[model samples]
Target: MSGFGNGRDIISYVALGDSFTEGMNDPYAESTGTGQERYRGWADRLAEHLARTCGEVRYANLAVRGKLIREIVQRQVPRAVELAPDLVTLCAGGNDIIRPGGDPDATARIFEAAVRRLAATGSRIVVFTGMDTGFQPVMRHLRGKIATYNMHLRAVADEHGCDVVDLWSMRVLQDRRAWSGDRLHLSAEGHRRIALRVCELLDACPPADWRDPWPAEEPLPWRAARQDDLHWAREFLVPWIGRRLTGRSSGDGRTAKRPELERLEPARYRN
Candidate 1:
């Protein structure tokens, strides 16, 4: 209400962005092969944490997987502003900069514009830079670009008086366990860690630690690792490339799962 990180209550919160914001990769019951699972990503988990701290809170998630920054600004930002929530978290531009020929600075510019607009509403804004992809096999080449984008993100957040989640600096995410099979979206455990991180930023409740150490790793056999890579390429990478070439998106016609700001409840998804 008064300002973020000052122990002030956040009554309403809205999330906007791409797949990361959309809560992909976190498993849920209703996901029946269409990939539009109501996976409770960090945003939802953060909302639940907020609800626990504030007794009740109104929340909405306008994030849809596979959306670029421009699409988010054109679509989700206005709706979030209309809702006029006390808190808004923006995590986008990953989809745009992930592609082979994408421009990081341009994407950051577009993203900053959206942040400026959202900040105009007097809502406490939360923004995130993309994680370091150097540890991921297929995404390592994008480390530089993602880093550039992260720098831009921090600058924009400073300019707008917005809080930053700072995903880039989260060394725990460098671990493979934080990623899903696609090596992009965060896994369930990963989402939990991120939820805790975002909650720390919001100063919501007892801050959950995201830096918990993972158990000792047993290295996979070379042959099994090769097989896993092949499977990933065939199932995830191929389809992703096909979508890009065909100019299609996973969220083409899909709308936000929780479009309207409403009271948070236990297990909202029926499926």
Candidate 2:
């Protein structure tokens, strides 16, 4: 458990999900571009745990904010296949359920296709999580659709022999303190809780051998925080307009245009 990553010379993880996985408004978002991760969301926190306790693991977040299952299959999932990650985490089907005038069954079909494609990889350890939608709005109709889609995800995990983390069922989601203003994304502590849970599970059924607790001098030392990694949400990871963007409106009429990033203090950039 302590020297887990050291066991594998190289370990990689790719995250595929909607906004929550992308870490829409998490106060502690890592600056992937020029900023520091600072143990922000689940992706960064999980990476840090592997680095500090287990050893080191290369991680990527291909999750988009407003991405539907169809978009993920077309855009993100392919690159994940190309990366051939040791572990892949899929947190999808949320947006598809809430899209403007969406068709839930169609989105589920796309999700099934994506999971099937990933299953073909025969990955040793694949993990998936359900969407988080437990809040005041309750989002009656969309929540129902999400339940249906998560059911499919469970089926995919069973068929492919992968692990599915029922994130929606986590206590953090059930607790009001863990969510932000909109009651959608997780707070800093919330994200940390998620990372801990995932780590516990990985440690339990670890795919590769644990890294050496005491290894010789490492090739690349973990670098200090970079200023470039600290920027306003838009500037942090925002690709060129021509590149690609998440956090798009799903047209569900529930998509708010206000900057939830406002909740995140720009002063953290003072760090």
Candidate 3:
């Protein structure tokens, strides 16, 4: 396991979790060998960083959108263990915690269990806290649950000797621009910031600081605000609710985009 400032070489890395780790909503066009396109999320960004510093690195991403903590633990964790990567990042439970009747404590327990299993493989494990969502008008109700879950996550990481990317404490992510129009996943910019933070956390490379504040934006007119909300509800919220009701998932029938260990691509950071 590599520690911060240890200057160790990371030859193999794997990412496991849900939409956030899957790089959802941060769309990109890539040749996945089936004429398929995909998003290059923080995991890919970090892999690029590692490759830059270490010459070459092997990487894999097993994340899929809409997976709950249990699903990820059951399906992805074992695969990650089989890979036995030198580095692994796990971020799950967000989809479960945001549900209407979800239990933060119960979810955290399962999350801790997943972490323990991954830690047992002796890979350097990195976990993340959900960003504070209190500022989002529609998602404000989830703030308490996120906070509680974060507490458990921190305690659990400490117990298992894992590194953490504490997104809950990141004030910059509270900005409205950091999120996508769905108010669920991060925007492209948000994913970039997360990649930079992960690089800083791992001491892989000195990328731009993730703490920089976003420039101010003029407030939208009352009419515009109403229209935006209506659009969001119709386009995103309603479908999410329908899926929940039907016991369906956004990740249903979806497989990992980058499932095997491969050489990292060049840095694609765009300032």
Candidate 4:
């Protein structure tokens, strides 16, 4: 049993995405995973929630800020497969529209590839967040791109049997107050809303059971997404707050061994 002591086997979940998934600039995790810094973002909340259900679980935020779809397919996806996680959640594709310019075709292809690889794991459950509603809501072009990417992502997820959070659709009702000053990154409340939805999604559809370990596959190129740290939040609030909140200091103590992502490999598309 884990120190939390719910007396259940620990389930492992691997997150693959951009800054959002990594909890950047979210002012959430004051304690980093390795205990070097604070990781006061949605991932920590998700982990704390997992502890209550599964009791003890390992959740890896393999997401690098500013990550593009191609880099994810080649690197993060591969690493996630290596971990053989029970469930995988993705909150990527936004950077593909904003950073280094948007490449719709390339973004879609790589995102599709990443999903394919993750699905190959067979018994794994995948939760996907769309590519919209971040950055420069004024930039009609980027906003349009986000819409397009989300549509494409939906088709692919449906084809592969993956569940989606539809954050773009869910948060459309909230205004600038929910958005950070940059007009792109999410405000503290926005992130908490997203995190709560994730918990619901996970609980609504549990991961499928697996009998044997997943087989390994060829590695793809990995590109580390670049992102501005959005973790500096003056306000910290967990809405409808869960009963089992990981004590900030205690959780910090547990993450002492985590490693910060320094760099990611660049990758090109397959077609």
- Give the top-scoring candidate (TM-score): 3
How many residue pairs clash in all the candidates, one count each? 0, 15, 0, 27
TM-score for all predictions?
0.92, 0.66, 0.93, 0.65
In model 3, residue pairs whose N, Cα or C atoms come closer than 3 Å (at least 3 residues apart or on different chains), thus clashing, are none
lDDT (10s digit) by residue, model 2, range 1-271: 2323445555666777666666655654335463433224676556555654433456677776666677778877887787777777777766556655666667667777887888677544445555546553435546666777677777767877777677767744555456654455677656656666676667633323212122344333334223323332245234322132444453223222221111222223321
**Segments in model 3 whose C-alpha atoms lie over 4 Å from true places:** 1-10, 29-36, 267-271
- Deviating ranges (above 4 Å) for candidate 2: 1-7, 29-39, 124-135, 204-271
Task: Sort by lDDT, best first.
Answer: 3, 1, 2, 4
TM-score of 3: 0.93
Ranking, TM-score, top scorer first: 3, 1, 2, 4
> Model 4: per-residue lDDT, tens digit, 1-271?
0122234465666777766766655664334465344444565456555655554476677766555566666667778777777677776666566544577667887788778878888635555545344443334556667677778888888888887777766643245445665544566655655666666666622222212223454543343111222222222222102212431211221221223322111121000
Better of 3 and 4 by TM-score: 3
Highest lDDT against the true fold, candidate: 3
Residue 18's lDDT within candidate 1 is: 80
Superior candidate under TM-score, 1 versus 4: 1
Instruction: Assess each prediction's global lDDT (C-alpha) against the native.
Output: 0.84, 0.57, 0.86, 0.56
> Residue 13: error of model 3 in Å?
0.7
| Candidate 1 global CA lDDT score | 0.84
**Residue 210 displacement in candidate 3 (angstroms):** 0.6
